[model samples]
Target: MQNVLQYLPQLLGAAFKYTIPIAVISFVIGIVIALITALIRISNKRGVMLVVKAIFRFYVWIFRTTPLLVQLFIVYFGLPYLKIAGIAPDGIKLVPFTAGILTFSLNTGAYCSETIRAAIIAIPKGQWEAASTLGMTRRQALQRIILPQALRTSVPPLANSFISLVKDTSLAASITIIELFEVSQQIAAANFQPLLMYSLVALIYAVFCTVLTFIQGYLEKITSRYTIA
Candidate 1:
């Protein structure tokens, strides 16, 4: 018990430094990518929209169907082999932190795009017609009316995605990123107490997830007040 207490601060501090940053940065980038993909999917142009739909569908399918650990391995370990085969002048060689961010961002984007699309679609068709009757262009209608309402509906799903992302960042340890779980592993290795160290790690993750859940509920309430029945 004393040994676990002694190492708790170090493990928690390391997690705050490494894990939080990776989750925040990756989720931010992921949100941007998701918004763009959702917009592309809804575009009215026939030829361009068809091409984008095919590409976006394939991207989402691959990322959603595969395991994240395999994706991390491909980014961190497999991509560098291109240089060995002389396929390119310079093969990609990403450090663990960079690799973790890239993999998480792409994976999150693929999943979140569907949530965003559904939110946008759920808005009533009459809302668009009402905006057009007021002499608003399509862009203005979306910006002034459609998007604001869609954003409210999107909150729950997007918050859930963010919470899932917080847990997923632990996978960064697989690529040697040295986040919370990795720190726990190192401590366990030296003290020969894997069970205790891992228990602490799980506890910390639960606390973080719990706090996010509270925030999600609060946001949902606030948005609900503004939503039309």
Candidate 2:
């Protein structure tokens, strides 16, 4: 009991210092990546654009299918062996934080792109036609009419993604990130009380996720206020 209390502050500190920042930054960047990917997937462009779309499609497929831990290892550990004669003789290595952020963002972005794509597709064709009749281009329609509605629909799923991302940051620990989970592991090792320490960290994660869910519900209400009824 004393050991748990003694280490509680250290765990919370790690959560604030590493876990929160990693998840928040990754999710924000992931949303940007997702939006761009979704838009590209839905575009009708050809020629060079078709090649671009193909690349993004492959990116989404590969990331979604692979395990994130393996992805992390590849980025952080394996990349260092990818030697280039001129540019990177010792391979392309990144710091632990950068690697973790990149992996998490790409992984989440791949999944979230599908969520965003479906939301955009759910908007009716009539809405696009109406925008076109109003002297709006496809870009204008997306920005002014279609995207707003799609955003409303996407909020719940995207919010869920953010919540999931918060939990997934724990995996960053395996890459040597000193996040909440890693801190707990350290404490458990010191005290030789793995179960209690693990449970405490789990509780902290639950609290973090629970708070995000409430925020998600609030955002849903905010986005739905101007309903089409």
Best by TM-score: 2
Q: Write the per-residue lDDT of candidate 2 for residues 1-229, one digit (tens) a residue.
A: 7758888889999999999999999999999999999999999988999999999999999999999999999999999999999999989999999999999999999999999999999999999999999999889999999989999999989988998899989999999999999999988898899989999999999999999989988988899998837
Candidate 1 lDDT, 76-140, residue by residue in tens:
99887667555565888889999999999999998898888898899999999999999999889
User: Which stretches in model 2 have alpha-carbon errors above 4 Å?
Assistant: none
**Candidate 1 runs further than 4 Å off:** 83-88, 227-229
TM-score of 2: 0.97
| Model 1 worst lDDT run, 10 consecutive residues | 80-89
TM-score to native of every candidate shown = 0.93, 0.97
Collision pairs in model 1? none
